[model samples]
Target: MPKAKVGRKKAVLSGNHYTSRRFDVVAVGASAGGFHAIAELLGPLPANFTGSILVVQHLDPARKSLLADLLLRHTALHVKQAEHGEIMLPGVVYIAPPDEHMLAGPGKIQLAHTHLVRFSRPSIDLLFESVAGMYGSRSVGVILSGTLKDGSAGIRAIKEAGGVTLAQDPAEAEFKSMPQAAVATGCVDYTLPLNKLGITLKNLYEAGSPKSYG
Candidate 1:
């Protein structure tokens, strides 16, 4: 995996110390074949990456998910299932608990048992929309390999809110429908292979400010 070069202006030091006015949080949505795609995306990120990552992957509501544990093998960042009312922190990977809708607030997490959207309880659209509303340009939204069109609208919401949005290249995706859908929205800022996605995010973090779309 390629290591990310740290930037001097807002370098993330050991532990939870870093400052930036750009993106503080990243919202990632994925489904079928996501485990591998997500692992590929996160493996290259530096250990002290300065942003929090919130993930919503379509999961079986009837069974317990070992997603956090599985993902821990691929990245140095702290990985765990998100809990309601927990304060969001930099460098942490928070996976939404099965059967719950994970929403973001200002520096915090909110989980709900509300009706499903897009036929899924842990809706990618809901998570992305919530983060877009709360963090605005201070957030980044990513759509990875999956089936169906779950993340399309959410990516649009993020883009409209002045945040960066990215999708996996459909040609490289194991399941291309989801990313293809997002790209069709005409809102994605970048569409790249999995390895490049991580590098791009690292570069964006180092930039220390949101790119002007104007």
Candidate 2:
């Protein structure tokens, strides 16, 4: 539907464990000041959301993961960090372990041993690019508050592959660089505010018709 975003490159196949074979995965990327924004998006998605979700947030590798723990408290969806070889499934939340790039494939999510891109191990671009290869237009990608441009290329890849994309409105982001960079790439479909993201996602699922999420 749109051209791929520039700035970096990244790559995958997602098998069907979701609602339908067409599309059943969504990938999200965040960093800098993204905690609240991420919670806002995840809190409203029902536990029955029929697609796999993969998330990567910028975090200190040396620190214990608090993102999944924090999200568990805010949403009904089961949340956990990616294990060595966990399959991608609907109704669950998969967060990339800090300091490692997450790759989603035919039926699972894996922690990559590859070198980090843009100085961040869990690069948003990596996650998005992988999702594009596997899920294509069926994937939905959202880039939220963050510093730097980790997710820009990922968003573009998603777009090129026929996936949909949304970015938090830069004016509404705690750290606008990431969203701004995504928008600048001209591939993002929606640049919504944090408060409006939940409904937007709900709408996307609804648009998918009988293949709805939750």
Please name the candidate that would achieve the greatest lDDT relative to the true structure. 1
Where does candidate 1 stray beyond 4 Å?
Answer: 1-21, 209-214
Alpha-carbon local distance difference test for all models: 0.85, 0.80
Instruction: Please provide TM-scores, in order, for all candidate models, with all chains considered together.
Output: 0.88, 0.87
lDDT of 1: 0.85
Residue lDDT tens for model 2, 104-208: 887778788688799889889988999999879788999999999999999999999987888888887999999999999999877777666766676566546
Candidate 1 has which clashing residue pairs, if any? none
Cα lDDT tens digits, model 1, 1-214, are 1222232222212222213547878999999999999998898788778888999999999999999999999998999999999988888899999999999987889999999899988999999999999889888999999999998999999999988888888888999999999989989877777877887777777767533322
lDDT score for residue 27 of model 2? 91
